[model samples]
Target: MALSTAPGPPPPGLSAAKIVAYLHGPEPYLLIPDPTPGTHQALVRWLQGRQAVAGPVVARTDAGASLRWARTLLALTPQWPGTAGELLFVEDHLAKVVLFQDPLLAGHLSAKWLGRLSDMTPRQRERMEQTLLAWLEGGGAAEAAQLLRIHPQTVRYRLRKLERIFGGSLRTPQARFEILLALKIHGMAAECARLRHRAEELPARAASEPRRDARSIGR
Candidate 1:
């Protein structure tokens, strides 16, 4: 008996179980009956030969397997920094099968960077957030100082304090680039939650409104 193997989703007449069995079988054997002699038999032999070659080739090239290995390494060591959820998400996204296999990039973010920002006092975080927004809005140190109602030197000092807490050389363009992205993502998430809450409030507000039109008609 000759075997048939098709790539991707199973053929119309085949079930998933049969397809899996064919792919995972120890030897390169097709479930299909042997084709006729001459041209058909030659084609079947060529296809079987290709299938034998393809199985090992796919296993060698599997990106998911490589990602699993990288995840295992991360699990074994706590050297990589950041929130566990953040690290896992970043690792999974960057380790997608389509992306060429490479070492996990999440390790580049230091542990200090991933530590709890909540450790900073709420006032400190609020001040830092204001300074960041001002800076992002193209405010110079003087403008930021005016916005915060602080001296220019105080603005500079607070920025330095923020840099220390964040654990990155924000002075460099490259470092600033990464930090800005992280900050923007965090801000957007907060904004989205706020907007969703406001949207939920709107329905209740509309329901509570007095029936002005009906009252006027009755009057």
Candidate 2:
């Protein structure tokens, strides 16, 4: 089937019509096109090989299917220095899949969620962060209240505020799972940054140390 190279809508053609119809369906179907002669074919073969090992087999076709497949893949993958929409799309998708594949990956996804939470008011963010830390360190409401130096009822109030901020639906098991995941991610990133700063200071610290052994050797 002939493909359209037009900037606007796809030209009236069987391939374009078929693709439009396929996209409207629920079951995921990737439309990959045959590679052009020479360089393109080699690249296509390489991509095909890579995809073979990643997960499920995506189908190939000649009607702009490969472009759609690539767009979808890129959309699902993380992007830096780009639109928030792209980042959010990738974060959401990764949260769904990465948790199943790698525990560490879940932490990274959670960090992205925390990044979103950072946009909230400072008071709200502080309350939630304190609550989360207390919950993690202490486990139960009583312990959390002790850590925060607040009464149990006050702790409950703060938690309820957090629940409202996070939304009532998120108070459930699955939602809490995501919230915990995000908190871990944020904590890991903070720890990593702290470690990195300490490492950077080491060289300066080493340089500033007195050369006692050198002076003794010279004498």
Candidate 3:
């Protein structure tokens, strides 16, 4: 599968007739960009039209972190809705945390859900994480702002920023669920990393400690 920066109708041969051939048999393979709602729905409709046979496993992610998570999806043995007309999408933006809702095989992948956040400063990361979690949990800006001790306008600003980063996932109910899961799992991963780092430091610190020999001790 080739990744293209272009968006819109997928390059030729992506119709129901050619999807399987392109994906599995090769020759004219699937070439799609990060899909927009228009493209996603179009693909959905194309698959819907072929609702007789089991469909192939194909998905697109609009999340900013998709490139990184793409490695995770590739590492797993993929499966798609065999019951034609079903849709599959993989993205860190939302849905069961990272696309497909079927937790990939990685044991420590919750960290990947952080996407770009992994590159952010501690304060920036905390604020973003808190804003998202509060907004989702409280179900609105006002409540979230109250919880975060900030103005609703601040919450709205943070939300808009998150919306831009996550793309269309913020607009759909299913996507919202995914966004929430991403936040939850990211926090879990961050904590795990902290613990792992601390554990590593403990061994090093222990090795460096000064020791008193039992023979040198005198009562």
How close is every model to the real structure, measured as TM-score?
0.40, 0.42, 0.43
Which candidate number would show the highest TM-score if scored against the true structure?
Answer: 3
Candidate 1 residue lDDT tens string, 97-122: 12212224322232224233567777
- Residue 74 of candidate 2: its Cα lDDT? 40
Clashes of 2: 7
Task: Enumerate clash totals for all models, in the order shown.
Answer: 4, 7, 2
Q: What C-alpha lDDT does candidate 1 achieve relative to the native structure?
A: 0.45
Q: For model 1, how big is the CA root-mean-square deviation?
A: 16.3
Model 2, span 71-146: residue lDDT tens: 3434233322211221112223343344334446665666655655667788887677878668656877899999
For candidate 1, what is the TM-score? 0.40
Question: Quick one: RMSD of model 2?
Answer: 15.0
Using TM-score as the yardstick, the better of models 1 and 3 is 3
> For candidate 3, what is the lDDT?
0.54
Q: What is the C-alpha lDDT of each candidate?
A: 0.45, 0.49, 0.54
Descending-TM-score candidate ranking = 3, 2, 1
Give the root-mean-square deviation of each candidate in angstroms. 16.3, 15.0, 17.9
